[model samples]
Target: MSTVHIKPVPVTPEEVIAVARDHARVVIDAEAREAMAASRAIVDAIEREGRPVYGVSTGFGALANTFVEPERRAELQHALIRSHAAGVGDPMPEEVVRAMMLLRVRSLAMGRSGVRPEIAEGLAALLNADITPWVPRHGSLGASGDLAPLAHCAMVLLGEGWVREADGSRVDAGPVLERAGLRPITLSSKEGLALINGTDGMLGMLILAVADLRHLLTMADVCAALSNEAMLGSDRPFQPELHEIRPQPGQAKSAANIHKLLQDSEVMDSHRNDLAHAVQDAYSMRCAPQVAGAARDVLAYAETVADQELRSVVDNPVVLPDGRVESTGNFHGAPLGYAADFLGIAATDVGSISERRVDRLLDITRNRGLPAFLSPDPGVNSGLMIAQYTAAGIVAENRRLSAPASVDSVPTSGMQEDHVSMGWAAACKLRTIIDNLGTLLAVEMLAATQGLQLRLPLIPSPAARAATAAVGPIAGKPGPDQFLAPVIEQVKRLIESPALRHEIEEAAGPLA
Candidate 1:
């Protein structure tokens, strides 16, 4: 198995993606172990002194004032895990659970959580052994550090929950741990709290979402360029000189990408001297850079936030080297919530614009001289007309999903936690929006490629030709309209395929 070294420092989203999606083995750094041991000494000392140190000795949230005796401290930790592992609904994808576990291990390795090094190592062992705990999709409020969801993950370490086996069946984790030469960890002072009290769940989703959006956004540019070429749109608006006056970095990059994709096109050349063509194109074609570029900029800001969160130790009652355990609100999910909400809005707009381009391709009156719906035989076959409807339905749903969940706060835990970030909700909805965007872009690719092929003798640019060829194998050529649902799925896979993107880039260089 390939391995990833986890240290007491921030890791990039790419690293998180590798572990979460690619099943990389994890090994904690020696320095991180030393740091964890040092912090554990402080927690042990506090336990010996019999001083109530929040999570170390006392009950949590509304019960913080209730102190437990040292003899029952271990029970407190176990009870905390059992109670907080109250997540409901279907289990989250194994990849998402692995990400949450990895992030929790990374935060604990920072040594500020006062967890024993064994606790961190146990989490790493689970990842290395490919033992994914059954974490439910709903539970976290995005405040109090994704407590419920993380607790479900922590339950597996204590040999108390279900784990996914190699064959994808859920089985008892205790047997799995024993078979892997791992023993269930015994919780010590603050160890259970350390395991569960962090922003690992939301942060994990945010990091993964960022990685997905990065690829999809770049692919969006490629799809837009193809649509623009098929629609016979002018490239004059994408000139570098025209973009420099406005000077949005993402905008300039997006326009440059479109300009490069349209370079040396026979289709474009065919219309270069045609004065009868409209001087400009519709907003969807002409403003592709402006809209997609704005999304690129939003993603950059979100990446910055994810980077900062990666470095943070977001636990309550964080241990310090000077022996002070201070309770702070560092675990609040507001920052991540705002970023997720903004990204959803951006994704919705990107999908919305792509739907517009798909719409233009289907309308006989609006599609220049192309046949109705890009069908080889109009009226007799619906062609891509319903595909446009599907895309529009998803686009409409995205607009509803893009409503910011962060703005609303609900009180919980006897109102001790009066305000919650709801960042988890935002992150979940953003994921849906990103998926819907891919489908929407796929519809545009299907229609645009068909429209370009219908243009015939006048071939598209090298980049467009490459993109069309990449998707052709999956979507096939436009003919008597067969069942399109399967074809749309195939095209969506192509849109998300890195190999297809690479093929296009080989012809047009890198996109924005």
Candidate 2:
């Protein structure tokens, strides 16, 4: 496995995706270590001077007015970790936890969090050793920095929580740390607050969601093209000249992609000059680029937000190089919340449009000359009729999930922390929407391919042919339906597979 080196500078969303989803190893750079040391020196001076600092010498949130003696400061740090590790529900996925850890490390590496280099090194060791902490899925208000979830992560570093082994078994972190030749170090002044106070959790999930949505958006264009060809729809709407008039970058790109996919299509050529065909097709076939392209543009905006977030330092009472420690609101997750909610809305619309295309492929009247439901005997086999229902159900769920989580806020910490951002909620629901969209697109792919197969002697474009061939290995040619649930799942797998998209792109050239 390749390793991703973390420096003091900001990382790109693509780098986050590589480390989070690809399980890449992590190493902190020398510049980051130097920055961390410089920051820690400021914190040490504050502690020595016995001045009251929010997280260094004083208490936190509602308890900020309380003072702590130097002798018991370490105990304060330990208690903070124990009390805040109060998250509930099922543990988060391992990938999410790992991403959270990496982002936390990156934030501390900025040298603004007043954390020691050893602390950052310990996190890197945990990633390198594959010892994942069990972080719960709930209890984050996305203010004061995903406190509960990150505290659970810090618990593992303190040798007090569970760690997941490579085989997926949970064990005491103490023993695992010992086995890895690692020892849990005591937290110094502000170290505990620094560990738990950041937007890493929401940010990590947002980055991963952006990567998935990007791929799915491109695949949507391919599915739309396949549906256009299978339904004998004209490629005239996708011509560059037609799209240039409107000039939406994403819309133009989508039209270009569809045009390429339908290039050299015998099925389209066969009906090119037929005046008997309707002058225009239905909205589902004719306006696919406009709908899907709008979603693509929304995703582009979300990606921009993720990129800016990656470079930010998100912690409270951040240590400064000029030797001043000041409190700030960088930890608030509203930015991430808005981005996740926007993507959710986009995913819902994209899935909804894809479902409509699937419906068109099944209706005999609308599917042009294709058989009813694309089944040899429509009444007996039922064909893909229920698959559309499944897609519809998922699209409906996505719509509900698309409600903006940022708008809903509840006060926390004795009202000391009020107006919290539900960014974490937005991020979690966006993951579900992305998964649902993938399955919905998969159903469209199956129906579109079946429609193309029924066209018989008249072949689809090279791109559509490649798409159908990719599915052929996983889902056989159209006929009387067998156990369709498995076929839908198999085709879903193919739709999500990079190989399928690679094949289509190879035949049709690069898609936008």
Candidate 3:
């Protein structure tokens, strides 16, 4: 297995995906261990002096002023983990749990968390062993660093929580660690607070969402171009000159991508100079780049936030190089929350526009000469009429989800941590938005390809041809529909996978 090393330098989105999604092994860097030891020495001094620091010698949150006896500090850390592992829902997917664990490990490895180097090494062992703790889905307020989710993860370190087996069944962590030739590490001093005190869950989802959206964004352009060709819409709107005056980076890129996809097409060329066919296309067909491009810009902005966050010291009472332990608002998660919410809003626009194109494809009045619903027998065979409905349904759901989660903050932790970021909720709903949009686009691909096949004599653009072939036999021939749900699922799999986008990019040079 390939190993991802945790260094003090800022990590990349790819690294997080590797450990989280790809199940790659993780190793803490040697320099990070040295730095952690130095930081631990400082924490040790504070403990020795009984200085009543926020997390080291004192109780947490509402109990911060209450002093913990020296011998009881370890018990304090243990109790903290047990109390905070209060997440309540079905377990989060293994990939998300893995990402959260990796992010927490990365934060601690930065040497500012005042944790023993062995603590980090222990977390690395769990990751390397794929001993993912079962983290419940709900209960994060996206402030104080995803406390509940990370605590469930931290519980596994003390052999207290459940870890998932190969088949996703839960088992005791103690036995799992023993089987992995490992022993659970006992938390000491500020270690427990350090483990759970960061925005790992929200940040992890944000990074994963960014990665997923990149693929879906490419698929959106491909489907839009397919819709344009299927509907016999003019490609003039996607010309570089039209986008240059406005010149939003994402808009220009989407325009260029659509241009490439619509280039060298028999369908486009047949009517390239025929003004008699139509004057202008609908907004869904003409403004494809504008919508998808805007989403791309939102995605880019989110990436900037995720990048900076990867390099951030998100733990509370972050230990500085000069041995100062200070309480800061670094763990608030507002920045990440807002970024995630913005992306959700942008993604809904992309899906909405795609939904409109799907509607145009099925409408006899709008779909040029294609039969109603693209059915061979318009009345007897409903054909892809219902696919548009599916797309519309998903679009409506996405609209509701696109409402910003960052602004809906509720007070948490007895109101001491008021105005919570709700970033976790933002991140969670964004996942669904990205997914539903993909399904919606899959429906578009289904109808667009069926529409393309109906325009049989005039071949689609080379890029559309490649993507259509990738969609398989269900989209290849236009006839009475058989099991529309499975067909949509089949194309949804194609959309979820890289095959469609890969084939399109391979045929067309590359999407932005």
Cα lDDT listed for each candidate = 0.88, 0.89, 0.89
Clashing pairs in 2: none
lDDT of 3 at 277: 79
Over 129-164, each residue of candidate 1 has an lDDT whose tens digit, in order, gives 888998878888988889888998899999988887
Any runs in candidate 2 off by more than 4 Å, and if so which? Answer: none
Name the lDDT value of residue 203 in candidate 2.
92
Q: What's the TM-score of each model vs. the native?
A: 0.98, 0.98, 0.98
lDDT of 2 by residue, 1-512 (tens): 47788899997666676677787888899999999999999999988888898999889999999998999999999999999999888788888898899999999999999989998888888888878998888989999989999998899899898887767677888998999898998899899999999999999998898888888888999999999999999999999999888988889988899888899989999999998887998888888889888888988888888888888999999998999999999999999999999989988999999999999899988888888888978788888899999998998899999999999999988999988999999999999999899899999999999889889889889998898888877678887777878888887777777888899989989988
**Model 3 superposed RMSD (Cα):** 1.2
Query: In terms of TM-score, how similar is model 3 to the real structure?
Result: 0.98
Instruction: Output the TM-score of candidate 1.
Output: 0.98
- Model 2: lDDT to the true structure: 0.89
Task: Compute the lDDT of residue 311 as modeled in candidate 1.
Answer: 91
> In angstroms, how far off is 512's CA in candidate 3?
1.3
